[model samples]
Target: MQNKLRIIGGAWRSRNITFSDAPGLRPTPARVRETLFNWLHYDIAGKTCLDLYAGSGALGFEAASRGAKSVVLVESNAQVCLSLKNNVAMLSAQQISIAQTEVSRFLAATAQGFDVVFIDPPFTKDLVPTTCLTLENNGWLNPHAKIYIETERSLTLSGLPANWQVLKHKTAGEVAYQLFERG
Candidate 1:
């Protein structure tokens, strides 16, 4: 099956994109995305971004539309990756690229640093802590990089890096989303 979502802001505002109905894939809700982008309005332009567990490519696409210099979307599923590639081509998004690989593998091998990163892994797999640690321990983030994380409401965000400070947090329905700034 295919599902559709709209880009709520930036140059591609109101444009709709499609995604495969892959298991464990939940695109960030529009309201949550709106809030996140608003919080990042001043920081997005000309920035490099990483969207781990890219899923529907919502966050990545949004960043690109908003003027991020580059956006790399990492998704393990082939179908999802295809959808993301299609959208990138459809939008002629020169700044966006799709990586068809597991998040951990991509993180381990990534050599470049990003100014912003979006991490919205599948629920109940306990992937966030390890992913956070890898991003911190490795040289994946530029100084003062902004990280956005979305998880189920019940998931406790523990063991995150000490230098990361929560700049914003909000809950909508079952999802809890936050913006953290790397010190």
Candidate 2:
């Protein structure tokens, strides 16, 4: 199925972005994007952000639309990365960049720091905790950076940075999402 998501707020508000029917590619729902942006309003402007496992680029594009200075969207799949690049070009989104690499490799190779990070790996992969730990250990997060995590409700986050604290959490059907702040 061809899937699409709309930007819920900021300059790209209401703009539709299309994606392929790639397996494991689930965009964040509109309601969830709205709520996520609300939580990020105070910190989003002019901040750098990372969207790890950026399957559909929904969260990364949303961050760019809402005034983030820059956004890096990392995805392992080449087709998905191509789609993301196409969307960026279509929108003339100079602030957004695409990284076509596996999340682990990208995290290991980059020393870039972000004020905000979005971690939404494929739900069945159990990547949340390990990705979180890598972000912390690899120095990808700036001081007090905000991290947004989306996972299957059945999965438990057992390996996060010790200093990180959950600032918000909610469930939408089988999806469980949380926002964290590193202290």
Candidate closest to the true structure, highest TM-score: 1
lDDT accuracy of residue 124 in candidate 1: 98
Model 2 Cα lDDT, one tens digit per residue, 33-145: 88999988899999999999898899999999989999999998888887888899999999998889889899889588899999998978888878888889999999999
lDDT minimum window of 10 residues, candidate 1: 104-113
- The residue-level lDDT of candidate 2 at 91 comes to 97
Runs off by more than 4 Å, candidate 2: none
State how far residue 110 of model 1 sits from its true place (Å).
Answer: 4.1
lDDT of 1 by residue, 1-183 (tens): 889999998999999999999899999999999999999999999999999999999999999999999999999999899999999999999899888999889988956889999999999999999999899999999999999999999999999999999999999999999999999
- Candidate 1 wrong stretches, greater than 4 Å: none
RMSD of every candidate to native, in Å, equals 0.7, 1.0
